[model samples]
Target: MPREVTSFSNALVKQARGLRDKKNRKREGLFLAEGLRILTEARETGVLPQTLFFSDASHRLLKELIDEVEAAGGEAIETSADILHKISGKDNPQTVLGMFPAFDTALDAIDRASAPLWIVAQSLRDPGNIGTILRTGDAVGAGGLILVDDSADPFSVEAVRASMGALFTQKIAQARWEDFVAWLRSGPGQLVGTSLKASADYQDARYEKPAFILVGNEQAGLPAAYEAECDLLVKMPMLGRADSLNAAVATAVMAYEVINQWRRR
Candidate 1:
């Protein structure tokens, strides 16, 4: 039996809605996630939300989820569609919404040798691009994503929604550029960067095990200093008028190239 919340002014609803802001999320140490499918992915990964809200329209669909949350000592609330929309800040919100504590994103938490490939992004600002990169990491069987410098928050609602559930499936880490460089050097890893000035064609590069594919800021591209740090800098061919690919797109291209190279060995 879950509690019922009908008013948008309810304290819990207000708190959940505030999670949409990065400051509030940091203060509360929790983030909001919407939709049954995404919540299911989190549950499957052994993560139960601290709080769950659902409307009558979604009751049947979220019955099991509600039960599981209650069983795990979490709060499950039955709310109205209007309340759901208020919490989610969407015109047509998902039937279900959840508040999950933020994950540990420290660079030291990552095990570098656990997987043969990892995706790294530096100074990326778009939440959508970050989400797409996470999806690509999951697709290419990369261990996780290591966000270097001031990348966008992966836990933001836009990023979470764009991930399409891949967020739960991959590990995420954030580190300063120097700290990340130090950490990678401390372990068994190869740093491969994507750059327009690089002479090596992406397809021709030899991608060693534990390859780290690094992409830079969307517009500024990789800084010369950062490119200089890479063991190998590879460039993708721009056959048309476009000089460069989208940051996330360039990452996906480089990631698959690494995977392909490893597969041939």
Candidate 2:
């Protein structure tokens, strides 16, 4: 049986709550995931949490989840609704939340057997956009996502919630623009970037096998220097007043186009 935790000042609860901040998450090397769907996907994807927390109202409802954690040698604690709300930083918090280790994949570890397509997001600022992109990447069969320097925290609660469980299944890496470019130079894929400066249409651009689609920040797009590193740069059509699409939507269109070409080949 899992232990009950009624106090707001419990050590484990305190630690879990602290992860709401980026610095604390960095210091502890852990992040939080909430709701049954994300938690279930975490287990399914073999990224099991080290600790699980449940409110009294959720204890019975989450018994199977608790049992799975206990079977895997993890700790499960039952706590009050208030503590769960506090930890989640939400008004109406889910019954179950988990503390999971922050994970990373090396750039070289990206599998190329499937002629993988990668999404490189540079200096992104919005957690919601980043999360939506991650989910879209998963939908479009992207091999992984790389976050350039100063990108928003992928482990942020808003980002995690926005991902809708895609966070557990995706391979993620981080690097500076210079380092990423150098790595890409030595890698197998062809680099394709999107920019308003380019004359080529997105659909007309040839998406060679093993392609990496580079997207710029929400407002500024890709810097000129970084734009030079791309093997090809293409522009999306803007028929309306808006000059650009949301980063996630742009990525989805490009990713699916790349795969669409590959499938037809």
Candidate 3:
């Protein structure tokens, strides 16, 4: 029988609650992974869970899922809805929240990747943008996501929720801007950046070899100096009044463009 935690003051509940803040995530090197589907996907993708928290309110809906986790050698515990709210920071906490290690990787060591598409993000601070980009990266079978400078933490609760477990499924790494630039120049893949001014339309660019595409922040876009580093600069044409697109939406459109082009060849 999984131990039932009746109160919101339990040690585990307190720790899970910490995931609502980025500081706690950084300090603990952990994050709260909520919902059955996301947690299950994380488990399937080789994320070793620290604990499996099941709410009493959610247990009826998730009993079988909880059992499945236990079957897979994960620890299962029961806590009430109040405790779950304290831990998960949602109006209605999902039936399940699993604590998983904060995944961290470096871009320097890997010489090349097997996947065809690649994504590079520059100082993207929005959690939603980071999550959506990760999802798009995974959807297009991107080689990985490159994080430069102070990008949003993918392990944060909002990003994890937004990603729908795509964060766990994708390969992501953090590096400095200089290192990323050097990587692009040193590696065999073509590095492409998006710009509103560039004459080259995104659809026109050919994604040959292992290719890397840079996704800038929502408002600022990539810095001009970095823009010069692109093997080529590409832009999405806009007929509407809006001068540009949201970073995440732009990234999705650009990523799948490469996917479509690659499929033809």
The number of the candidate with the highest TM-score is 1
Error of 3 at 174 (Å): 1.2
The ten-residue window of minimal lDDT in model 3 covers 56-65
Over 9-95, each residue of candidate 1 has an lDDT whose tens digit, in order, gives 899999999999999998989998899999998998888899999886345548888999999999999999899998899999998
Per-residue lDDT tens digits of candidate 3, residues 170-253? 888889999877776776888888898799988888877688888887778888988988887998989999988888898888
Model 3, total clashes: 0
Query: Higher lDDT: candidate 1 or 3?
Result: 1
Q: Note the Cα lDDT for every prediction shown.
A: 0.90, 0.86, 0.81
* Tens-digit per-residue lDDT, 1-265, candidate 2: 7889988899999999999999999999999999988898888787778899987534444777788888999998988889999999899999889999998656666565454788899999998888898898888888778898798999999889998889988788888888888887775788899888899998888887678899899989888988988899999889999998999889888898888887887
lDDT of 1 at 55: 83
Model 1 lowest lDDT segment of ten: 55-64
Better of 1 and 2 by lDDT: 1
Best by lDDT: 1
